[model samples]
Target: MPPMADIIAPQAAAALLAELVRCPSVTPLAGPAGQGPYGEGRYAALLGDRLAALGASVEFREVEPGRPNLIARFDGPAGSPSVMFEAHSDTVAVDGMTVDPFAAEVRDGRLYGRGACDTKAAMAAMLLAVQSVLAADGGLRATVYVVSTCGEEITGLGAKALVGDGFFAGGRVDAAIVGEPTDLDIIHASKGSGRFHIETRGKAAHSSAPADGVNAIYQMAHIVAAIERDVAAALAAMADPVLGSPTVSVGTIRGGSQVNIVPDACTIDVDTRLIPGQTFQTMAALIHGVLDRSRAARGDLQYVIHNRPAYPAFFIDGDAPLPVLVARACREVLGRSTLRAAPWASNAGIFAEAGVPSVLVGPGSIAQAHTCDEFVEIDQVVQAAKLYAAIIRAYGGAGAPATGARGE
Candidate 1:
């Protein structure tokens, strides 16, 4: 390994972030004549080269047909515990951005571009942290894996593959640190999410004829109203202490072909958030119970509900060594302790389900994610690098916590 002074610097990390912003690795990867590079491969390769420069063995493994996740590992002593730092490489589409999405422009102490805050900033920080650790200590007591995963903005295909397939050869991970914008705070718990569609079918009839056909729109209105009154209220009362309450929102609705005809069918898409101790099955059953009562009352509605898979909510014990290590890193490096729960779902939840204790920590703010003119403060990115480096030194170097097991 190289010496600390010769390893990548904070400025190099920022420059690397600019290079990533220039790739335009949009989700639903599309690469053709006019389209941007596909599967985020361009940016993945760019990151891979940087990792390789720091003596990490890098591999690009396919998660989907064209989309791949980049896995890089820095070796340590034989049989040493291992830890992972993961960040997504993909960004949401830059459809309505107010600024040039790929320019990588810097102004007034900020870097402006898509994926700047949502994730790429954290990615840069983690990379530099690993570089710094390897440079200063030759190796670590724990082997470290720095994963730049793809498809986090959409399907989470990358994390799924890595966790399900044991993509890393370094046995089981002792801890996984997922990077997301928390304004440099530490997140040990988060809500899960589920999506489903509700449809009500009815007979179509001419609008000129009154009371000749069942009105699906009217029926759906009743269902929506019932959900708002019954389901939402019930969920609100059964809140999770850390994640607050589970909630549902009717996001999109469609009905009626034209105003001249009574609609034959109506459909609504719903997003439901889940807190810990709530399973998707239990939530679906509750929804069905409410809808059934509505059906029983009217005895005149025809409706169907279909639910997609749910992302399970997760909470790690706050007093655990991982959080302790992270908090110590923050206090020692940044002179502050910022710990909170994130409202949004990330791959961290999925990792928890796989029995890997995970936490979300990084730079910037979540508000900037997926927004037009999205940017990350330059100072935040630099501080994030320092924080991550401190964590690596504290947990992976000689000062590692003594109480945690491999999967704790």
Candidate 2:
């Protein structure tokens, strides 16, 4: 088979990424599915059709009512390893952007758009590599599932459904390569995120009679400080070596409804970055302890915590075959490779949680992800294609499947 460079023209590569960026796939809000450009259905349609044209069997399965995930399967020899290349179909909100979000413009060799750096570039690279190998007669080495998952930006719903539905045809895929902006490095470990709202309740009263009503907002200040000071210290003591310390931050706060009324309720949304060993249960206990400490100081405090869905932490030992092969593949393509950790999470973690041997890799710098001017270096996208092709080939040739590598 010819090299990917010979098969994929430079313009063709850029054009593919440009086409993906041109689609509007911002993660949708709580609205009717497929009603507008906000959901991933339209983008999934484009990818599904293209993958189908490339001789893959495509399936559009909805994670939500209209938000479908694009699953495309490419056949190989029957006994070969099955590998999944998962690139998210949704981007962060386009609330703040210096460039036109869906313009898909190229300037000074940078492909600029909303999802350009965060993941659309990775998706494009995966598509090109798959296409190149498929063009060669009987050159496809692995059974590949090129999946474009939806709802990865805010919720991991798409991944959850994929796993719950057993999308792998009753057999686990050998290795899953989750695509994110990794500067072409292999990310085997990443911090997960947990989000929840902490609310404090109090009796309402008029401003003139403030002493009669307990102030929930004022009490919540103590809880926030305690979490930052006490809970953070406790979390640091139990930090993972690779992913480092778990962290907590307060994002949005709301208290009194009006100026003159002593508000009966106040809530603060909290975000926590979790290490591998931490779970939602542990996070709740730690914060509950902090809240208890604050309650001991004042008797009138009333509090409740409302939990939200969490993205899991990802980790695998360095010696594992998945990471080893990925590193080798990158080195083969770019003359070097780096295995590292990430503070932010991705679909990789959810796969890891489901007992799939998973790792994160792809083009572009994370600094550009979700930025006002989100863009990916065109060269990096090309490198990503070659890297993925090499990795899939190597994984297929290996005698063993990727499993039993993650630690508790």
Candidate 3:
């Protein structure tokens, strides 16, 4: 293979990133043309076309119609382990942005756009890095898969579908790199997330008729307070060294429509971030217990708990081959090694749950993701491409690297 330096050059990475930022691939929201959120189908198609032009086998997998995922494979030597580089194609909706979300404008050294920092930049870097490596002898001991997934902004449905399809069946992947903006930090673990909708029911009655009916809003208030107290305590006590601690937030609440009438129903949407060693089932049971205790105290109220698995927490051991290689690559290409953990959820968890060890490493910062005027440093794009090339060289060989510490 040619030297890694020649494979992922600065100019090539910057050009790829610029091309990606030019695509207006914002997540779709409810509204009119150009006024509403941008669609990702066009961007996926563009990426697929580029991959095909680069001689990689490209497949467009549609999770939902018009919202497609692109998978491109660069075949390597026979009997080599497969490595997947994954990133989301979708960006959060740009509802209240000051700048043109699709301009891909480069000011100073940063590229600004909706998806520039969130993930498209990382996708571009990975693609250019893979293409560069393949351009060289192309006779490596591993196949590289570039996957651009949809619905990462909404429950990671694209990743779930890919995992459910057994895409990694037959022990194909030895390791995976999920390109989430981490400021070039290597994330070995990330918190899992679960969404819960709690509904309380009661009988409506006239406001003046004191004891005529039960007030669901009033009942829900008590329940919400109890949950806040209990959940806060639980999260604070359940702390992990790497992930820090679990977190709970009462994100949304809806109750009475009219002020005079006693409301009969109330709904509370809760978002909980779980650290490693915590499962959705376990968390759900804890929530149920909390509700049960509250209900027991108030026999007049009725409530229901609906639990949804947003994403599971993932942890790769500190000594894991993927993390080690990623750290080494960052040191070689960026003059520093990265070792950190993500506080939020990402698609890396999906790969880990599928038994494919994965790590998160990419350009940009998480702070810039899902925000107005989102941008990524042009230099970070180049550095990420070089790091990708280094990882490919390090892990695309016989005998995979060793596993590291599994963050508790």
Candidate 4:
């Protein structure tokens, strides 16, 4: 069969990306999802139909009401190893975009729009790769599953739901490749995050009345100092070489009604990055420890804490089957392979935690993910399709690359 890379022309890849960009899938964080400007439902439906056209069995499994995961399965030989190509369907809000977020335009070989670089480019490439493979004269090298997940931006609710959703029946796929913009490099390590809110409460009083009010902002200073001075060092000490130190930073703070009145309440948002073995519980414990120490020092300190769900960090050995296979596939198409580590979390961590060996790779650059005028190089998208198809072809059959067989 002809190389799958040769199947999808640059124009087709660009057009598919244009269709995806034209659809507004910026996740509406609140309320039920709908086929509107802020939901993935519209985009999911479109992609589902495209997958169906390629002779894949398509299904929309809702992880939340109106927010569905579009899963497309292409069956190969009965006993062949199966691989999942997973990409997020949601993009960040396009509040201040320089160009029209839904206007998918090709300008100077760059496809400009929201999510064009972040992921839609990868999504487009993956679809074309699947098409090329299926169109080949010989049957598939391995079974393929193209999954577009929801809620990757705010929280990984979809990925969380995917763990035990029973989509794979009692068994699981042999490997998974998470689609994220990595300039086509392989990402095998990344940090997780636990984002939470911290608030300090106090009595409000008129500024003229001396000693009449306790300052909530002043109370918050102790807590912030504890986190920066006390907890930060401990996080640094436990750093991993690949992903570096897990860390925390106070992102936002709000307090005081005006300059005259004493503050009654103050709220601060904290973002914590975690390494392997850290979870939401651990994040809470670390914060709680600092709060307790602060309270001990200040007898009148009062505070409330809310720990949001965490996105787990992921680490796959460079020599692991999936990473190795993807690396080889990258080399096959790009003439070189680069294994990398990321500080930001992605769906890779979610799938890796579920016993599915996973790695991250795709077209475009991470720097352009949420920029004002987001764009991806047209050539990169085409290259990625070839790389993905190469991975699929090498991963199928008795001598496939990703099965992790020790002796064959």
TM-score of each: 0.91, 0.94, 0.93, 0.93
Model 2 pairs whose backbones collide: none
lDDT, candidate 4, at 162: 80
Better of 1 and 4 by TM-score: 4
Question: How would you encode candidate 1's per-residue C-alpha lDDT over 51-103 as one tens digit per residue?
Answer: 89878899999877657889888886887667889999888888889988888
lDDT of 2 by residue, 219-278 (tens): 888888888899889987886878778888899999998888888889999999888978
Clashes of 3: 9
- Pairs that collide in candidate 1 are none
Regions of candidate 4 where Cα sits further than 4 Å from its true position: 1-6, 30-32, 399-408
lDDT of 4 at 351: 80
* Alpha-carbon RMSD, candidate 2: 2.1
> Which of 3 and 4 is the better model by lDDT?
4
Q: Which stretches of candidate 1 lie over 4 Å from their true place?
A: 1-10, 29-34, 166-171, 397-408
Tell me how far candidate 3 lies from the true structure as C-alpha RMSD in angstroms.
2.5
lDDT of 3: 0.81
lDDT of 3 at 90: 84
Off by over 4 Å in 3: 1-10, 31-37, 402-408
By TM-score, the better pick of 1 and 3 is 3
